[model samples]
Target chain A: MASALINVPAKAKRGDIIEIKTLMSHIMESGYRHKASGEAVPRDIITSFTCHFNGAEIFRADLFPAIAANPFFSFFTTATESGKFEFEWIGDKGFSETASASISVE
Target chain B: MRFLGAIATALLVVGAVGAAEIPLAERRSGYSFMKPDTKTMQDDDTANPGMLWVLNGETLWNRKTSAADKACADCHGNARASMKGVAARYPAFDKATGRPIDLEQRINSCRTNHQQATPLPFESRELLSLTAFVARQSQGAPIETGADPQLAPFVAKGRELYMQRQGQLNLGCANCHDDNWDKRLAGAAITQGHPTGYPLYRLEWQSLGSLQRRLRACITGIRAQAHDYGAPELVELELYLMSRARGMAMEAPAVRP
Candidate 1:
């Protein structure tokens, strides 16, 4: 099973540009690699990541084979109002993990 | 030039002159040699991947096993209080084996004797998780090994191995780490070999690893035969390293490139 760590501030001023950081555990193995026996090691990587604020998409990123293992994502989003931030990551082999954090804009 | 000659002749000089030891004030942790960004990654829990293993370990510590039907927490209770500074004191002398054992061996011993569970394989994710979890509890605690009189012989043996030259390259660990540290090697800085961190996140491996793994890699890099995991030689080496790095703060789960 995979694990993830996410950091989102709990509070921010209205219209503040907030930073969100997410790190997910995945081998992100590039298919180009091979085993000691000359056989190819299967490629596995997180293909996409998206963030939603109050059900509206705030951020999205498409990943590729070259991404490092345990890919980390950091981006900015303007804090418009008090709401929840939802995160989702999807990848090969039907892999998916989601987490949510709430924010209060004062 | 004389220093370079001495390193080239390290094999002959190993049993003669005592290994040139680094001064305490001059010592620097591997963390000190890392880039600003790499250090930033390590300082932020949200960014460091080793934290993932630490998270898994916390779960494993609480979950009940199949055979013993007991979790580690059942016996040790809250790890925060019970495990603090524990990792700093290994590789500890085990009278039962009449040798020193590292933290990984001690973890497996607990599983075999008390938890009735099969030992996790070396370098396995599960084992790394548990060891990282235990060691994380000792973050910032200074290493306190080598005080025990019983471990004198093993520590001596370890020092021998560290200073002896072998493999096709014919290099001892001291040649680069002790003799030429702060110098660049193939674009990477040579760090003084301090066992301050283990089960750390290495960018090269893209995974968490133990000191033994790093040692084996170093040995193989010089074209020498590597010791098997959990070998007494490795444990003894770990002992001597901990002793040599005495009072250095623990930084397991550190991120390094």
Candidate 2:
């Protein structure tokens, strides 16, 4: 199991490009690393992250082995209406975590 | 006899006054050396990654365990009130142990003695989280430290160690922190080594770490054999750093590069 934290404006104006920040606790192990005993550690990374605004996809990203562990993302998305924003992160070993934040727009 | 007593009284007052004069500005908070963005990251709780540890600590504070079934909150009540400025005063003298105890040792002492719980391992997440959480309570408070007569020997040793060169490099903490502060080393500006912000979030580590961990890094940087966690020498060094940092505001759980 994994945990996540999301930051978004509690209130915003319509059509405002609000900043969204997120952090997830994951190893994001690049599968290329070797253990002390000369064994290759299997890769485990968050392969995908998607943000949904009111059930509609606003942004999505396909992560790679290069992404650092405990991936943090800060992006901007226009506020269309007062609604909930959902975040989902999927990774190797069937690791999936989700979080949500809501914004009130005038 | 009355004349002798008056002379002793006069000497006592002078000594007390001399001891009370705090030399501020001899040290600077790590925040001043940080990039503007880094400082902003530390200033804003939402953006600070260190807050994650604080959040966990809050949860842990209220959660009960053991046969006695005690939580820190059960005894301390609200941490915000009870723990305020507590971190700023440590590594203070611990009368029970008749020794100096840093924040980490204090936390462990509480766990084993009061909570009846197993002590968390050094550098463990739970310990770091708890220490960070407690230290955060003292944010913005000025740090004040002095060596009590009982604790003077440790402080003296710490000061001696701070100036003593070690390793192949033969460099001491004072060489850089005191003599060459405000200069750049390896492209990073050097500030007077201050311990105010500890159990802090470091972007380089991408995790929270304690002051001892940072001190060990410095020791290793000089190619010296590093001390094990919770070593007495490290505690002494911490005490010295705190005393050097007297009157400076604490910014624990601070963000740094």
Question: Among these predicted structures, which one has the highest DockQ?
Answer: 1
What is the overall TM-score of model 2 with all chains considered together? 0.88
**Top candidate (lDDT):** 1
Residue B229 miss distance in model 2 (angstroms): 0.9
* Native contact fraction, candidates in order: 0.96, 0.08
TM-score top scorer:
1
Chain A TM-score of candidate 1 vs. true chain A: 0.96
> lDDT score, residue B53, model 1?
96
TM-score per model over all chains:
0.94, 0.88
Report fnat, model 2.
0.08
lDDT tens digits, residues B127-180, model 1? 999999999999999999988999999999998888888887677787777777
- By summed lDDT, the worst window of 10 consecutive residues in model 2 chain A runs over A1-10
Alpha-carbon deviation at B190 in model 1, angstroms:
0.7
What's the lDDT for candidate 2?
A: 0.83
Measured against the true two-chain complex, the DockQ scores of the candidates, in the order shown, are: 0.90, 0.30
Q: Which stretches of candidate 1 lie over 4 Å from their true place?
A: B1-19
lDDT of 2 by residue, B72-141 (tens): 9999999999999999988888888888889999999998889888989988888998898899999989
Clashing residue pairs, backbone N/CA/C < 3 A, model 1: none
